[model samples]
Structure formats: structure tokens, C-alpha cells
Target: MADLVYYVAVTLDGYIADSDHKLDWLMAFPLGDDATPYDDFYRTVGAVIMGAETYSWILENSPEAWPYANVPAFIVTHRSLSIPEGKNITLVQGAASMVAAQARMAAKGKDVWLVGGGKTAALFAEADELQRLFITQIPVVIGAGIPLLPVSKVLNLKPVTQKVLKSGAVELVCDVVVG
Candidate 1:
């Protein structure tokens, strides 16, 4: 069995993006030699699960050549969507449990990655489906925007690893202690 890891980048104030769904602040923080985490993740993770909004944001912001070209991705969306040809993108609707199940099945022997959108991550977090959270906090404050984690009763996490980069970015890898 593989664990579900939510690896995402966030601002100092815990915002993943601004109110307009713009990652301009995040754009300023370069990934310089920071591909190690993502590379390792893609290597170990067989599938990715993301919300429709996050998927749309990627499609709108990402390069012409999709980043997750080889790995399978499940996009949870309410509206109809089409997966680009030759790309391993699947569309699913309804609840988070169903999508998480689908992602687990698709993951095979490798881990499952819960990518992007604070609400989507919160769903898995609330359900106690997510095991780990790898957050690379960029040094910037968006003031107000989409939070890195949705408002909830209470959530606890214990740090497992930490790393500081030359760009002043800090990465915290923690295990979720769901109650």
C-alpha cells in the first residue's frame, strides 16, 4: 500500500495563490535546483489527484508541454473536461473519497500525490486520507488569497524533515496526526 502525500508550495502567509487565482507571487520564487522533491515524487508516485480548479490553473499557467506528462493524473471536476491526447489525465466527479479511491487504485505499488488547491487538500486532510504534507514555503506574503489549508476545527502535524535553500525558501515535510 502507498501513502497519499500532498506536496505543495505556499507563501509565508499560507496562501497558494492570490484571490484572482494568480500565482504571480509564487512565480517570483524560482525552483532553482529545487526539482529534487518533485522529481523524487514523480518517480515514486504513480498517480496524482487534483481539484478541477487546480487543474485549470495548471492548464492556464503551465508550459505548452504539460509537466506531468508520464504519470497518471485524476482531475476532480464538476463540469465536462477533455484530457489532452496521449496524456494520462482522467476526469472524475462527486466526492473526495471516490477520487482518492480511484487515485489509490491507479497508483498501483507507488505512492499517490495529492496536488494543489487548499480545499481539495483539506478534504483529504479532514477525511484522514492524507498521510504526509511536504510544503515548500516561499518567502512572500500575499496579504489575502487562497490559503494553504482550509479553515477547520483543529489539525496537528509533526515535522519529519526540514530544508533551507539559498533563496530563503524553507521546506517542511511533516506527517499528519489526524484525530
Candidate 2:
């Protein structure tokens, strides 16, 4: 049994990416010692999951190589897209719970990482599949952009830990309270 963690970085305004869906704003900030925390978290992830938009962004940005080639990558999308050859990637369509179950199985004993694009994460949260949220709050504020979690329903979270990184980013880890 592995926990499905929505580990992501968000701006002060609660946006994950800017209005253009660009992470350039986020890339501008240096992680400094914060890199260690991310490195430590990444080590616990056995499988990665992301929405179609996130997958497309990665394809366009890092065309040369797949970043999560070592782990099983699952992309949830309704549209047809071609995956790079020799990459450990799978295109899946359907409900969030189904997709999450697949990722959990692939993760084995390790945790499943719910990689970005707010709608996807919201779907999992709505389905009661998401277990944990590890949010790194960047100091900058983006006026308008993709929200962190765009759920209409209220989801209670219990704080697990909080830390202020060297780069001025505040990391907050919480457990998603489920009924």
C-alpha cells in the first residue's frame, strides 16, 4: 500500500503555473538548499502520474530525453498523443480512481507521485484517492494562472510538517483527511 502524494510547487497567489501555463516564473527562483528536500522526496516515488497538459509541456520542453525514464510514467488524457519510443510511459484514459489504482500498483511498495496540472489532481482528490499533499509555497505571487486544486468541495487537510527553505520557499506537508 503506497500513499498517493500530490507534491508540487505553488506561487503565493496559489497558482501552480502562470496564465500561459508556463513555469518560467517558477524556474526563475533558485531552489538553493531546497533541492535536498525534493531529492529526498523523489527517492520515495516509484511511479509518476500527470495530466495530458503536463505531459505535453514536458514533451515540448524536454524533447531530448524523458526525465522520469527510471520510473513508470502514467499520463491521463482523452486526446490521442504519441509517446517517445523506448520511454517507460503509458497513456491512460478513464476515471481518476482507476488511473490512480494503476499507478499505485505500479508503485509497488513505494509512493505514487501525482504530478501537476490542477484539474488532474482535483479529480484524484475528488475521488478520494489522493492521500498526501506536499506543497512548496514560492514567495512570488502570480496574478492569474492555474490554481493548485480547483475543487468545489471542501477538503480538510491536517498539517504534518512545515519548513522554510533556504530559497525562501515554505514547504508544507499535509495529510488529506478522508471520511
Candidate 3:
């Protein structure tokens, strides 16, 4: 079974983006570690699932034609969207359970990454479907924006790995105890 890992960057107060859905705040910080972690993550991720908000944000901001060129990505959205031709992307519309089932099926041997905005991650985390959470805490704090995680409930996680980068960003790897 593939573990669903939520890998994301958050601020000190826990925001994924600003009010305008711009990640300029994230870019303000000096680049911390290289793509080693992302590379390692991609190696283990056979498929990825993300919220519409996050997907749209990347589509609008990413410079590359298709940021997730090789990898298969699924975006959960209510609105109809035409995924760019020749891209390994899918659109899934349904409840969290349905989405998880589809993502798991696609993941097969590798892991499924829940790359997203707070609602998606929080839903997976609440459902106990999110197996692991790898958060890279950047050394910056935006007074207000989208929070990294939802403020609805508390999630109990066990620390498995911890690494502090030279740029003061700390990467925390934790396991989501799902029954």
C-alpha cells in the first residue's frame, strides 16, 4: 500500500499563500536546502493529489510549461477544467474517501502525495488517510494568509525525522497514526 504523504512549505504562523493567493512571501526567504528532499520525495511518489486551489496557483505561477511533466497528478475540483494536452494530470471530483481510493489505486507500489491547500490536507488528515506529513518550515512569517493546516481540529503526530537547514528552515517528518 502506498503511503499518502503531505509535503508542503508553511510559514511561522502557518500559511500556504497570501490573501491574493501569491507565494511571494515564500520566495522572500533565502533558498534553504536544495531539491534533495523533493527529489527523494518524487522518487517515492508514484502519483500526486492536490486541491484545486493549489493546482490553480501552480498553473498560474509556475514558469515551466508543465511543472509536473513526468508525474501523474490528480486535482480535486468542483469546476470543470481542461487539463493541458499531453500532461499526466487528471481531474477528480468527489468526496475525500472517493478521492483517496482513486489516488491509492494510482499510486500502486509507490506513495501518493497530497500536495495541497489546507482543506485538502485537513480532510485527508482528519480521515486518517494521510499517512505521513513532511513539512519544511521556512524562516518567514506572513501576518495573515492561508494557513498551512486547518484550524478546525488537533492532529497528533509522531516525529520520525528532523533536519534543520543552514537557512534556519526546519524540516519535520512525522507519521500520521491512522487506525
Best by lDDT: 2
| Regions more than 4 Å wrong, model 2 | none
Cα RMSD to native, each candidate? 1.9, 1.1, 1.8
Estimate, for each residue in 1-179, the C-alpha lDDT of model 3 and write its tens digit.
88889898888788878877888877778755553456877888888899888888888777478777767889988888868778889888877778888888877878888988888888888877888988888878788888777836677789998988888888889997655
lDDT of each structure? 0.84, 0.91, 0.82
- lDDT digits (tens) for residues 81-160 of candidate 2: 89998988999999888898899899989999999789999999999999999998999987999999999799999999
User: Between candidates 2 and 3, which one is better according to lDDT?
Assistant: 2
In lDDT terms, how accurate is model 2? 0.91
Model 1, TM vs. native:
0.90
Segments of candidate 3 deviating more than 4 angstroms: 33-36
| Candidate 2 clash pair list | none
Q: Write the per-residue lDDT of candidate 1 for residues 51-146, one digit (tens) a residue.
A: 989988888777498777877899877888767788999888867777888888888978889987899888888888888988989989879999
lDDT for position 127 in model 3: 76
